[model samples]
Target: MSESKDFLRSIVEEDLKSGKYKEVITRFPPEPNGFPHIGHAKSICINFGIASDYNGHCNLRMDDTNPTKEETKYVEALKDAVQWLGFDWGKNVYYTSDYFQKIYNYAVELIKMGKAYVDSVDEEQMREYRGTVTEAGKRSEYANRTVEENLELFEKMKNGEFKDGEHVLRAKIDMGAANMKLRDPLLYRIRHVNHHRTGDEWSIYPMYDFAHCLSDYIEGVTHSICTLEFENNRDIYNWVLDTLGLELPRPYQHEFARLGINYTVMSKRKLLELVEEGKVSGWDDPRMPTIAGYKRRGYTKESILNFCDQIGIAKANSMVDVAQLEFCIRDDLNTKVPRVLTVLDPLKVTIVNYEGSEVIDAPYYPHDVPKEGSRDIPFSNEIYIERDDFNENPPKGYFRLTPEQPVRLRHGFIISCKEVIKDETGKVVELKVEYHADSKSGSDTSGIKVKSAIQWVSAKEAIKAEVRVYDRLYANEAPESLEDLNSSSLTVIKDALIEPAIVTEKIDERFQFERQGYFYADPIDYTDEKPVFNKIVGLKDSWGKKTAPKQESKTESKKQAKNEQVVGTEVAMSDEQQALFDKYTSELKLNAEVSNIIARDEKLSSFYADALAELNSPVGIANIVVTEVARELKEKEANELNFTAKQVSQLVKMVDDKTISSKIAKQVFEEMVKSGDNPDKIVEAKGLVQISDPSVISPIIAEVIEKNPDNVEKFKAGNNKLLGFFVGQVLKATGGKANPQVVNKLVAQALK
Candidate 1:
């Protein structure tokens, strides 16, 4: 895959091309107030990725401006996270406190130049006078102090002559400026607490707004990248740099959208709440959105970088679906990880035709994944398969282990369920199956064929281990306010049976537990006596199309290709199907394709007709039913899916009303196929509603233009094709839910 330069990287490319700076220098300045989350990971990648691409030095700076919440522990953890993400800061690692003297000297320079002043107002009075955006701020009584008087007070603040919050240094910027951040923001505050690294040398600490810009100046940084929330602060960032008269190559501030993934809160405060409330185990809990949590959960560092790259830099905030992240991990590990058999929910099976234990050589890697090695798996008369794989009273389309039905044992022989044994409560305890002697894998001669083939482990030799499964941390797609935190995010299967090979693997090993999901040997909990595994991601996407199964050659593969399910009602369509059959055959005057489909089953035909009847669009509904619905029915019956006829009406209505473009509607409908949820609920839950309203979309467009100034200029200079690029950017910002017509019009207006 080719790498696409993000807006930030594009800026670097232009600077390099235009000779704006000899070399690019960026920094990842984390505050060390809390553990790093996925949002911070994006920042780290952006900063380091740019510097590496430009062949320039990158700095890992600790912006420990506040001593109250800062600690050495967090500093160490942050460093570990950056290093684990595969970034080397080299020898340029720095701290803002390291330049305390220089920052203090710059503050004195500001005071001598009358650009900064000391204020004796109390904290309450200070905030009261700072005023809202609509109201102009009132100047402090102490703001008009003489330059010598202000200098004396500032020195006193540093020497502990003033108590905490008694006196502070404030910049002399406009008190009534329209941009609130420029309204004489505080330069320094009195903090009597001892610093973590500097100790009790100074009683006052520089505020972040003041220390950040000056530190960048002192370090000669070329560009300072921040999240969108800091865009308003950029004015103050420049005010400080210009007021201090910093030399050339002064750092320029740029803002990009921060990553806010669905199902997890990126706010440090909220993540801390989860840890403090016992909602999760700790910061490193596998369910946490923290980088450490991801590491503990078996996610590769490369996968995180890949995910960050996939979601490139944007100017407007949007919630990315968590499934995309899951896809990255699954894709990263798919071909590289070995395959194994693990029964999560076990059911006992007894082979009546087999007398003793027989060893079968099973390839450790699937044919799609190229690797050599086979493990001798001992198969006995008794073994275990997944409990859900068997059915006493089979459903209409159940294919696995019904009574008297033969199913192939993975890498073993074909077995037929002869009898099902039950305990006193009539609960099934064991299945008695007869195995065909000639049906052994690789040498099968039996002409019999079965639709189901399942993975199993020998009951006598299988290793017992605990497998921890994880779901999304929050039930809501956008947990903006912790609206719906999922209570059952973690599940532990205590008696999972795995092949013996899994027990001896290394701690960092990952494997595909056939039919289950990709799992990792729990690095923190694995033991030789009792192994533990963590489920990284499931094989099947619950919110989209089913991942295509691994392709297998019919000559060497034991698994059967999927076949369309036959409806149980063979004689006639049900009453529901009959009514739809009559409608399509007579009044609607549809073709044989519609009539033949509706004649297959009463309920299914009714489902198709109901969708068409509600939408009153035959061709559209017919294509959807013949294609999407038919494809889904291979795995489950029409009635078994969560999809409803009414949702189809809603989906078609979206296309008709232009609520969603045809492209986005297809995505919505596909999600409906996977989850069987309503289109409206899916749209609302996933933040997929179109942004046709100008008030909602104009700011996004303006920001996109502001971020990609070069591109906007080129578009204005006769590059009409860039119009599609801008439209695509808006679509991405809105998660592909923006109406194209509105976006095209608004983008043209903004460009003009």
Candidate 2:
């Protein structure tokens, strides 16, 4: 495989070289149940990206099988998302509904071959018959029906003779096989609901596993690519084709990790709920993670594509920190957008020593940017500066305007605060400042040095505009529910002051609001009468920790880490604790370190014991109790905990089942702490299921490596100590959700 090509591209290139069909045809098959999000964007990029790279063609297909929820609006949304990302789906868009007849014909073929049966068992009974993972599923007695009888029942189902769930056509793949999906998986089910496209033409719809492969076959899709969650379905994908004696060189299934961003929900159901529940304005709410949301929020298509390119493709699934995403917008807009003055929280500043107004010619683009555009910024004696720019009693490293510090009004003359005016509430409402007449921006003669230039708008010429400052929508990095909806997500500065040039002159839609954030002219709300601007993104600090205060000071944390030792610490455990730890490690197979931490505390041990009683998972239970439950226990007694042992046990079971990752379990645990909600409900509510198929983490890992080349070179030079640093970097990038094992292995190989 070429170094530049990802695994999917590699597959495409090899297939084309081997003459596995002349063209590399792929499809972006999205079910139109909800608006497409960035996850869909990744799929769009991949399917179209592969096709484009190989000089092939990709078809935009709507797998609109489930008519219960699918809507024309969602279908239009899917199309919009694809086109907005700058891709063409050829002349005709495909719909699975269009091939219903062909799909039904294939099902009839399966029945004629005695490979499928019409099962009359109820939905509940079918589930029970599917059985547990360890135990083999039992075939329904209805499976004993002859092929002719089954065909009659299926025809009845299609003719709308059967009610919903009365009967389902199941593939006769396997009953005692370990892969339970093949345990007579449903080929088709009768749904009386109306399909968006098909209308009342068909009452029975083919299952995803049934229709997907056949659709790919009919479409001549060379490579059937999907997210890792469908890895098991690949078995069925091939089985249907192999059983049917389909044409040679049929599409082969391949899986890639789906994109998952921290602090956002990607599940279409959850997103739909958010839209329906009025938590957001709509699917296109600027705060939503949907492609339309990002577009409405002023994210350029180029930036979105660049982010997809930067994140790259990976094989393992993991949570990606939203900081990396935020960084992408900042990086993209830094050079492309213009700079303008806008005060979010205006504090009136009067140049007491100044006389008249003046027009200051300031270039819209910063000095570093190569764009050529300048606007005459109106400056006068009365101006409005950001309230934050003037701290009455400044901090030690304060740089902006204060009683003592002198600052330059960006593109205008330097000013010194002479007097502070306050209202009855003691809030600094205004500032009286003196300006240096000769210290104009272009021709400065004053020898005084200022730390920074703050943005300001002339009170007389300032346009009254509403600036909506947007923050991360979810309060928790892994959102739990409406409870996690950030209260400060949308803060509207109704009367923010901006330089008149933006309103008067013909300027670009997006602009960097001087010291605040990238601002977009609100496409839906901006007008001459009522100017509105949406904050696209804030200027990211170097490390991107919410533009944190003193978080960049890693010295103390490093010193503490060196003292405690990252490998292991000599944790003091009682004799009773020691004995418990020994039993946990030796008998229960718990990690020695986790066992030690849990056993060291009587309350934790008690909680751990109760959880163990509920579910006999020693390692999983002990890990959470030690790291997470223990922390909560540190501040409160066990009885005071919001959650119970049984809840913790259920959480561990989810981890054991790979339903959620251990890192995600921590998130669920936090929500559990707040509301004492059951772990399962929390997971479902938050859509906290882990997305395996790790390729999404690859680009982030590469980024972490690139940002710390010194550590990379050191690791290559045999300083093995840096391995933890690299792992930590990756973990931090993933909000501690990237598989540590994967990170350790990937980092080691990359450094080599």
Candidate 3:
């Protein structure tokens, strides 16, 4: 939001600071041949943002010069995408067709000045004559046509005397120019195709290189901004503007790096191919990188703009991790959207002790999100939970429903599984449980506790919906170059169950589906009769395991203790390690283990200092630096991380402040390590945050209690040693950061 630090902005700022331009004016010119993608979003922000910051104006110019590829549909889609990004062009919207006559007059003036001529080279011959980057082009024989003859021929060409590609107008610049773009580029091409806007008014259309610069000049665009691909075209841009002897203060072209996302190809041609071939549903397919695609996928306008801002304009070309973009949207939605519960793979649970149904009042703002509202969801003896929530033969650390484990029914009471009913095929058909009669969510008299609480929808009140989970369209980093694509990008679940409130919610509303992921009503498919929702992203990075404390055996501890000061025992320490170690331990108050590991590396020390600068919490950062960062540094050098110390510090602070759990932090840290990206970005991109608010965590814990009846019995029968085991289970179930103190107290009360 502050003055942009991008190279393009620096020039604009210098121009503004100086009296060169009274007011800045810029334009977002799209060819209107295809739908705009995330690449255009960056340009829109740059051009429009600069103009806005300087109190100037920006024009939305649809470059409909080549009407053969342009269409009314594309123009509308472009406008919709711009508006969806929360920008307005006001009365500054214009089309290249609007300036056809003016540009024609400029071309005529060039003919008069003998700076242009008519050429009759065929398309194939022109390609042969137009030399490569390393070669000088051969001049066309028709380049020397007399000005009077050229003017007459041009008039005849415009009058429809020339067939398509039979004749062309060429600038008379040097043929031997090193820049092929400047080697007498074609100023106009004869095309008999009717224009989308002009409609047969002229047989010839001015080329983009000729029309673009002139359009900017005509509209008083002070700064003509484009992507790096157009850098070579700037020479011809200036030549046309200068050759016509245009008025003073002509628009100057500036280029910056375009947005390139991993696993996303922004080529309009490729994207169109995908749509036409049914590789994707349409241009607005949530998997596509197009602006419309993101909008339909529950990505907020604020998030896209934030993403553009974070990946600010640069001159150099680079591939940005898509996680950065995801982070932006997730961060924006986190505190604003309410949380909801939906089960994609439903498994029925029968509470044997409860006879009838009841209504539980649950806060819509159960999570950390700052919201206010409550919804009455039906709670009955019969409910549908996620199929994966129950495991008959549970893993060692599994915290959800087991054969004899008690778990809490979120927003209701604690329940323990009494029996597991299976079909003939051995698939879990139903789970019979008994609920703690007095353990109501609020104002409970029955002492009950849980390690995990699983969400469930009342079987009687459940709403059936089709849920679509979308993943990266391309599994490879650069799918543009690779032939292989991710064929399984979209997975459709036909029988997901949602609470009653989801049916009444408006389209495009975002909600965290409890332990699942953030989802939104499909803008086009969602309906009252048969609802559809798209899983925007999962709660954690679905790609990896959650962060758990690394257990050390007594032998390993003894080994580490014996070689505490030995170099390269686990990692090589630098000569500066002692000083940094003392400083962090005594001055910064960081733990010994973390300081010992981090001080050995200059990059880690700098990262530590930077993180310390942003966050005052040393222990929080130390935990990550020692465990997560050290693990990464063991194999690679610090420079390879591609992240700054400030990013590390911010991530540490997020965990220290309990914005996300240590388990969730591990997921974020993994992404950061892989991409060398910012921690905040990884968290946002992956939705790796811990929900510690009582409203959300209480239900999850209750489910854990009810699912583990045998553990509860043991604790009650003088086996107090199971307390730590119960706490570990709760932590594991809740992604490892469940307000430990709160879970401990609740567990103690439940066993009482």
What lDDT would each prediction earn against the true structure? 0.80, 0.82, 0.78
Cα RMSD, each candidate: 15.3, 18.6, 16.6
- Expressed as tens digits, the lDDT of each residue in 1-752 for candidate 2 is 11346888877778778787798899999999999998998899999988876778999999999999899999999999998887899899999998999999999999999999999888888888888989988888998899889889999999999889888999998888787778889999999998888899999999999999999999999999999999989999999999999978799999999998887989887888888899888998899999999998999887888788767789999887776677578667876887888887788998898887779999987544557989998888999988877888864555678888999888788999899999999988888999999899879999888766788998998889998877778756667677767666888889888888888884888888865668888889999778898888765321222222334343563454345411111223345765786677547866333554566668988988899999987767876775578667876997898999999999999888877877678778888999999999988987767644468777887888887787688888999977977886777666555666677788788778
lDDT of 1 by residue, 1-752 (tens): 12335778778778778888998888889998888988999999989878876778778999988999899978988999999998889865799999999999999999999899999888899899999989999989998999999988898889998889898899999989999999899989989897999999989999989999888877778889999999999999999988877778789999999998876788888888888888888888999999989998999987899899878889999888786788678757864777788898888999988897878988776543446777788899989998877888875655667885788888889999888899999988999999999999789899877664688999998999999998778755557555467655789999999988777654238988876778988888988698899988876354322112335343222222123222210122345544555566345645333454545544556677678767887655654565456555645766787787778877878777777776677678778877878887877887766778899999999888887798888988999878977987787777677788899999988998
Model 3 lDDT at residue 127:
92
User: What lDDT score is found at residue 369 in candidate 3?
Assistant: 39
Task: Assess the local accuracy of residue 496 in candidate 2 as a C-alpha lDDT between 0 and 100.
Answer: 85
Please tell me which predicted candidate would have the highest TM-score against the true structure.
3
Q: Which ranges in model 3 have alpha carbons more than 4 Å from their true place?
A: 1-4, 442-449, 481-483, 505-508, 544-752
Relative to the true structure, candidate 3 has a C-alpha RMSD (angstroms) of: 16.6
Query: lDDT per residue, candidate 3, 1-752, as tens digits?
Result: 33115677788889988878988999999999999999999989988888876778999999998978989989999899888876779865799999999999999999999899999988899999988888888989998788889999999999999888899999999878988888889999888898888899989999999999999999999999988999999999999998888888889999898888877898988988899888888989999888888878888888888789767778888998786676566556655666677888888998898997778888776333345787888998899888877889875555667877877777788888899999999999998998888888776687654555678999988999998888778755567633546656788999999998877754237787876667888889888889888878654332211111237553564455455532111222344665676676556655333455567667667766766778887777766675567556656776676665677787777877777766677667666666888877676765656655777666766787797798788888999977876776777676565777677777677668
* Alpha-carbon runs more than 4 Å astray in model 1: 1-4, 480-483, 505-508, 543-752
> Of the pair 2 and 3, which is ahead by TM-score?
3
Q: Estimate the TM-score of every prediction.
A: 0.73, 0.73, 0.75
